[model samples]
Target: MELGLEVLGFLLTALVMIIEGIAVVMSRRPMHSILFLFLLLLTAAALFIELDAVVLALAELLIYNGGITILLTLAASIEPEEIRAPRIKPDIILPLVAAVILVFMISTYKFGNVSNFSYTSLGTFILSGYGILLLVVMVMSIAAALSATYMISKEDVGI
Candidate 1:
């Protein structure tokens, strides 16, 4: 039963990642692509949690899914529609080159054996070190959202 559930979880995670990857690349609208990317990050975070990498999962959720996703969504919403659409057909070479570089980097990397990699409890570490930073980030995100709302609500002279 447990084994079956684990297998199901893994399958679902892989499916989510595959779907997100395809959707992100095929999406024409910038906002849609960003939304798909956010989904991808969320799936990745879930995968991390399943693997018992809770810290990594939290990082993925808090950083990419929360911070970067919000910023990208805001930018997409604020940008002109014409600019949001690709002006030129994307060149294949750039992505190909990037893929090659990524593959090479991954293949050549060496993860040295760590005999001891200990971490403090998440609660302790957060409260001792990152607690204040987290609060500040939350406040900043709220401020940004409020400012964006104000900017959008303001009457445009050109409109």
Candidate 2:
């Protein structure tokens, strides 16, 4: 009975993620798309929790849902009138791509030994070998945020 409930919960979370993912792609407005993306990431974090990857779940919530989504929302809010207009026509390609990704993830979940995955080991490996790469990525993210802030300030100053 417990296992059944877990499976049901997992399936429901996956369904919600798929729907929100589609909504994110189909949204005509940038803000609406960002909102859907936020929800999708939240669901992804829940999925991680279901998989017993608590560290991953926290990182997903903090990094993607908290930081990236807020940054994107701010970027969208300050877009120029011409740029705000939706340029990409709604197409079937996005949904197809999402489906493919879902399939791939499901297959990986079924075949991969997720129980053996250790966040501590991964962290150690990254810190030992790719610490510089991680530092560079953080620097780049900070630079991007600063650039966005500068652009927003300049626009406000009528520059």
Candidate 3:
């Protein structure tokens, strides 16, 4: 049935998100972390699609996975030798605390069914009433790309 498939999709999305989060936090290399973060963004986009938020899913792909991830990857590659050096002492406390907080939040919240909201109406509002938010996201993505390019080029000549 359709309901069973929806439930399976939700479970798969949650599982992917959890694994991606762990991989992002655990990876020592900047590029690996960025890759995992990109995967997380993709899984989030999948969740948006499952909820029938087509516009949001597209924005998630284009703005986040496409723009921000590329910027992050480029920035990571431009890091100095000292910046890429491994830490003498790995700090695990902050990540553990964050994980605990995330678990607590998840356990305490009640997740509502996606059918509770009308996706069509949300899409209409996004396209009509709150179209400016979409524009802002695009502008921000462009700004991030431009800044990253400038910084990388400047640092190339030790400027």
Per-candidate clash tally: 0, 0, 0
Measured by C-alpha RMSD in angstroms, how accurate is candidate 2? 8.8
Worst 10 residues of 3 by lDDT: 85-94
* Runs off by more than 4 Å, candidate 3: 1-3, 81-159
Misplaced by over 4 Å in model 2 are 1-3, 81-125, 128-159
Worst 10 residues of 1 by lDDT: 108-117
> Residue 157 deviation, candidate 2, in Å?
19
By lDDT, highest first, what's the ranking? 2, 3, 1
After superposition, the stretches of candidate 1 with alpha carbons farther than 4 Å from their true spots are 1-3, 83-159
Query: Which RMSD does model 3 reach against the true structure?
Result: 9.6
Name the candidate that leads on TM-score. 2
* Cα distance off (Å), candidate 3, residue 122: 6.7
| lDDT of model 1, residue 41 | 82
lDDT of each: 0.68, 0.72, 0.69
CA lDDT for candidate 2: 0.72
Which structure is stronger by TM-score: 1 or 2?
2
How many steric overlaps does candidate 1 have?
0
* lDDT tens per residue, model 3, 48-99: 7666675687899999989989988887888853345433222453354335
TM-score of predicted structure 3: 0.57
Give the lDDT of residue 124 in candidate 2.
Answer: 88
TM-score of each: 0.52, 0.59, 0.57
